[model samples]
Target: KEEERLRNVDVIRRNGRALGQIIDDILDLSKVEAGKISIEHIDFDLSELLGDIFLLFSRKAQEKGIQFSIESTTSVPSRLVSDPTRIRQILINMVSNALKFTHEGSLRVIFHWKYETTDQFPRSGLLTFQIIDTGVGINDVHQERLFQPFTQAEDSIARQFGGTGLGLVLSRQLAKLLGGNVDLEWSEPGKGSCFRVTIEAVDSAESSQSVPHFLLSETKSASSEDEIVMTLDGIRILLAEDAPDNQLLITHILESSGAEVEVVGNGRDAVDHALAGRYHLVLMDVQMPILSGHEASQELRSRGYCGPIVALTAHAMVEERQRSHDLGYDDYLTKPIDSLKLIQTIRLHAKDQDDVKRENFVATKFSSIDSLS
Candidate 1:
């Protein structure tokens, strides 16, 4: 049974990841629906965020042979204090929709200044982004309803385009979060659509030292020896799973990697353990008796649990995922969990600490492991 469970990890991991993404998307929407959405404003490089978004969708654009361009005018601010993640989300949803409906023509992204007055060239320019795609465009009648929460242009278009029709709505809401709004500039049916996003920009400060890119590398392959060597070795993980079998499985996986694992059966117990323990990470199950995972997470957040709390759930849907984040969970997971992904998420949040330990380990007598093949 033990060997069978270990061997099934691959299939379990694959299924869990797909479910996880679906859950994340749902949870995001739920948060928005409940007005539980919160934005964190931070100084971020606009170019870096754009570059990441473009890189993410570059492959899709190439597959369609559609032109994807990013244009910034001289007046545009390169740096700004804003919600970078929300901005990226808005861009990705817009671009994805454009590509989906666009079959024959090019897709262009233009970033320029939206002038307020002819002579008043303000220091803070209205940063406007226009996504123009050569594809089937919306009619004048449907344009008004496009940004409405759940309704798309038509049932056929909604089915054909393949989306929950929440993208545009969410994008607009996100724009509002960033102190701006999304407006339909122009659209001609069977031609294309143009979306105009205008946001206020502040003067760019001297760029902060660029941090190294976060490597979101594939972790699909690794021998047990290799995996054991690189897995969480020092981080203490507090796992709140009610299922006895799941708890045992996860505990085995974490302990094998030399991580200190503490398990609880319910949200209330989880909270109690989390407060009492010096944990580096929390794997919280969303549905638990005595107190729901959301309730527990809220309690922890209120008490200032600064460490990462990754939500776990059997409910793999967009609404569920959104609710997890809305409740202040840092990340999420789904049932029949992938031990590797669980570790991966735990690692993602613990990366800063991991990097320091790795560097020091490399600098010391254990440096030989750095170049291990």
Candidate 2:
């Protein structure tokens, strides 16, 4: 019975995550259509980004009996200048489409770039991403309107395979916004499809050239001055959740990241705990007995509890988010919760905002915190 209960909880969490992703995707596509999407050019690890993409789609493809792999023609630089979010968005869309159509065989992503070497940094180069999949390819006659906002290849296809159908359109708009372009390189009915994107990239040396600061544990001395901040390990966390399943899932997730968590059933307990305890973070669910998360947060702030407080809610309404923000919540996250984003948000908002900007801080400082927990 215990095992079955845990399995049911996992199923609920997964379905919540899927629904959350669909909502997020719709909002992103709408932003694209309204020409309000922002493209940020920031320095990020190229290898790390691609590796994450590979890991994400690899699991999905595996679940559907499709082989997935990433290949590179040349040595991709470790650090590159580009908008990781948009690049990731494009890759994610292509991979989702590939997985949706492909039943068997393999899905492969190839990275090829042409660069010019300079004395200091690698000059801007054309980076080509080719996604090849052995799937039910679209016919030429229907391919003309493939990138339109509200249309798919056929009505029957949309019924058989469910989607918002704005994925390809949003991908094109995002690629162009990033000074790149997306094209259906080649496709033949019953064979497969090849989608390609070309973008410009320059090498970034900030990571290679900086001395970084890192989170430090309360006990251990730092090896270098950089790793001397507060670590996540041993930090007390108060989780205000009414649902037993969510409490279990969230506790497991936070504990996995080395945080010591305490659970409370109502907003009243949450406020009482926050006032008496020295928690480093709080995961507050919005709807609770006695008082809502908003009320609890307002009370906490009123009592000068300045720690990072994040809201877990299913509502995506603008007024709901603004109300939470106005009520002194530090950050808001929609449910079912995304474990990775949850960790990142905690780590990000736990420390001072300026502290997170140091490009060289490694995550190992926090990993050791797990041992303490």
Candidate 3:
């Protein structure tokens, strides 16, 4: 009975995650259509990004008894200035589709780049990715409508595969937004398909070296499970949330990471508790009774409460984030919170006093040595 209960819980969690993804996809599509989507160009490690994708799909491929690999066919920069989030999203959608249709054989991702001199960006280039999969390939009739919203290859594929059929639509739109495009290079029914995604990227000033071939099979020994573990042991947090479900959810997430969480339903109580007690961090929900989160945060800041106060809201717009920052919030997080990100945010703001003291001591000793030298 215990084992059965655990399995049921796992199923529920999986379904919840799937539902969340669907909602996020819908919101993203709406933003794209409304011209509200924004693209950011920042220098990020290309190798790290590809490694994350490899780690994500390699295990699934292993489970399905299919080979998976990612290789840089040509000289690829180690870093690039592009929107990593959108890039990952587009690649994930394509790879997910490939995996969904492919029941047997192998899946491979090949990426490379060609430098081009442009007026706006001196070190710009077209970075292309090709996801090749041996799957139940699409025919001509179905291929034509593949990029349409809510339209899959066929009705039977929709029934059997269970998807919203928005992946391709979103992928193409996002790629275009990044000054690139997504295309089906080739497909043969009952054979395989190759998806090509090309996007403009500015080579980072520091990335002069090219990345070497990276193979999934070679990285099998390096456990993807060896991820950085985040903990908030012995930290105190004040949570200001009106919704009972959100309060419960947030509390559970924090307590599981060894944090001491005190929940208050109103902003007034939050202010009172935070002022009276010493808390490492405060999670203030934007909407509440008695006083709004913004009002309470402003009040706290006025009263010289120096601890970090993070805003929580359902709004994921850039204006909303800017408003939170302008209102003196240390950070902003959207609803249906990602647990890992939440933990990371808290850890970043709530520093351990012992660690701080140790760091200070080390710095002092180093300074003394420098003086002697």
Candidate 4:
């Protein structure tokens, strides 16, 4: 009976996570459709990113008794400036789709790059990723509808695979946002498929040099079984959330990291409590009763509160993130919050006693110098 109960609980947890992912994908699709999605260009090590992907999918391939490998050419620059997040998303989608369809044979990810000298960028190139999978290939008729929203090649695929069919649509949209596109190079029924994703990337100034090990410290492989252990000792967090479930969830996650969390039901109470108490950081839910998170943050700033205020919202739109910054939020986080991200945000923004004393000392020293001058 206990084992059965545990199994049921596991099923519930898995289903909840699936539902959460579906909701997040739908939000992303809506943002893309509304022309609100934005791309970010930042220097990233291509090798490190591909290594992380290999770590993520290799285990799954092993579990299924299938071979998985990633190969990159020497000409492909190690460092490139592009939207790493979107690129990772697209590649993950492609690889995941490939793995799902593939039961037996091997899967490979080939990275190829072609450099071009342009007036704007001396070192620019097209980075292409080919996800080749030996899977149950799609027919021509099914391939036509692959990019359609909420669609699959065949209805039976959904029944067997259990997917909402938003991955391909989002992948293509995101690739286009990054100045690229995803295409099916070739596929034969009962044989295999190859998906090619091409994006524009400029070689960073430091592309020739290797990325420091310390710089990749945070780039760890994703593991569901391991619990994140981090100490946020002597940190105090103000959590402004109207939802009881969110309040509990955030409080538990923060508490587990050894941080003190005080929950407020509304923005009004949040402002009052925040003013009355000393907090290292504030996690403000964007939409709250009486006063919204934005209004509350503005009020706090107006009242001369200098602590970091991070906006927490369900809105994943780029404009919503920009508005949070415009409204005095130190940072923005979209919900349902990943515990690791929440803890990392707190650790990044929370100021301990030593930090406070140092800042105060610096201010005093600067003010004394100014007075003397």
Q: Candidates' TM-scores?
A: 0.55, 0.65, 0.73, 0.69
Q: Give the total clashing residue pairs for model 1.
A: 9
For residue 312, give model 3's deviation from the true position in Å.
2.9
Query: Which digits, one per residue and each the tens of the lDDT, describe model 1 over residues 1-373?
Result: 9889987996776556656544555667777777776666555567666765565555566566566666654445556655666777778778878888987657777776543433433434466778888989999888888977668888798666556677787778778766688888899998998998867554445553322222112222222233213367777888898889888998998898778888999999998988777777789888889988889999988987666678887865546656676787777766667665566556546643435233122111111100110
Q: What's the distance in Å from true for residue 146, model 3?
A: 0.8
**Candidate number with the higher lDDT (2 or 3):** 3
- Which lDDT tens digits does candidate 2 get at residues 1-373? 9999999999887667666666777877776677665556666666656755665555456556666777776655667777776787788888888878888777888877678566665566677889898999999898998888768888888787767578888788888887789999999888899999887777675544311111111222223334322235655678999999999998998787677889999999999987787666789999999998989999988987776678889975545556676787766777878886676557645543334333222222211110110
On TM-score, who's better, 2 or 3?
Answer: 3
lDDT of 1: 0.68
Best by TM-score: 3
Candidate 2 RMSD to the correct structure: 10.2
> For candidate 4, what is the lDDT?
0.76
Models sorted by TM-score, best on top: 3, 4, 2, 1
With candidate 2 superimposed using the best TM-score fit, by how many Å does residue 50's alpha carbon deviate from the native?
2.1
Q: How should the candidates be ordered by lDDT, best one leading? A: 3, 4, 2, 1
User: By TM-score, is 2 or 4 better?
Assistant: 4
TM-score of 2: 0.65
Candidate 1 stretches greater than 4 Å from native: 1-30, 113-125, 204-373
The CA lDDT of each predicted structure is: 0.68, 0.72, 0.79, 0.76
lDDT of 3 at 68: 81
Give the Å shift of residue 336 in candidate 1. 9.3
Which scores better on lDDT, 1 or 3? 3
